[model samples]
Target: MKFLADNKRTLDALNNWVPNPIILSSFFWGAGNVDQRSIDGLLCSLLHQLLKAEPGLGPQLLTRYPEWTDRATYHDWSNKELETALFLAWDLPTRTASLSSLLPAAEAGIQGSMQTMHF
Candidate 1:
């Protein structure tokens, strides 16, 4: 049980780093008609490239929107929901500023870490 719990926690943490389901779904929708295997391969390739180029962006997005745990689940989301999630994921500065304002604890934690890292 503990192992399962720990694994779930780790997977959840990792999901935070990956792209949201809606983004993935949008990409797939744009991929045009293709065999399932090829589509999967394309998506994997695109996701790999995205992660390589933007290291923490994936996790940051996942952290910002916990609803995007499973990519498949996003297929059912309304267009408005998808748009909102995409906006949040793509606009980090705005998200960060909003978060900093809404969550004083996050701001304090960041400040504390910055203070300790001073050379």
Candidate 2:
């Protein structure tokens, strides 16, 4: 949850502060998508900003998580990352209940095998 908290603070600052186009692009890049090149560009832009803001956090984070440089490989993130990204994207709103509410009922007859899998 610390990532989510930090992301929220970052967003709060963004809401009150206007960053350049490059930083804006990075924020959009954090939204998961299939385009590897675009994601890489965004990550680089974010790194640029982080380097300016904290100096050390950028290198520390990148050194610890080098996979972040490769969007194709990094796309399949762990649940924690997904949760953090969702929290960041949605302003840290309570999503557990809403997510459950949004699931289609079994009787809706969706045809995906993954949906029918049993834990």
Candidate 3:
């Protein structure tokens, strides 16, 4: 699967490159919890968190965003809670999240946040 493919790419890139682990932050549309429904967004979100946490990446920082979920939803995701939420929301099968949805949602969320921050 492309998800695994991309994860492998990023992980391999991270593993082979021995350094202080500075993530080149993506121009993510928003902040707070990262959107991880797709590889592109996942890459950016991971980079953002990595950069935010690692002093070597840049200045210390944090992010905010919409459809709030954490970076763990990427590599560290577990399905049970989400499945339970779906079950509680509706006693029917839910469509998988769209790979296309993440960017626009993130953009809107970020724009809202930036406006709030008066940037």
The numbered model that scores best in TM-score is 1
Q: State the displacement of the C-alpha of residue 114, model 3, in Å, after optimal TM-score superposition.
A: 31
Q: Order the candidates by lDDT, highest first — what do you get?
A: 1, 3, 2
User: What does candidate 3's lDDT look like per residue over 64-107, in tens digits?
Assistant: 12222453553443333332222232222221111112345453
In candidate 2, how many Å is residue 94 off?
A: 22
Model 3 weakest lDDT span, ten residues long? 92-101
TM-score for candidate 2, residues paired by index: 0.25
lDDT of 2 by residue, 1-119 (tens): 22432454645555564442112222332234533224333333333443454444444544656765554553455434433332332232211111011123222222242233221
Q: What TM-score would candidate 1 get against the native?
A: 0.31
- For model 3, how big is the CA root-mean-square deviation? 15.9
Off by over 4 Å in 2: 1-37, 62-119
Enumerate residue pairs that collide in model 1.
16-59, 17-58, 17-59
Q: Relative to the unseen true structure, what is the C-alpha lDDT of residue 90 in candidate 1, on a scale of 0 to 100?
A: 45
Better of 1 and 2 by TM-score: 1
**Best-fitting candidate, measured by lDDT?**
1
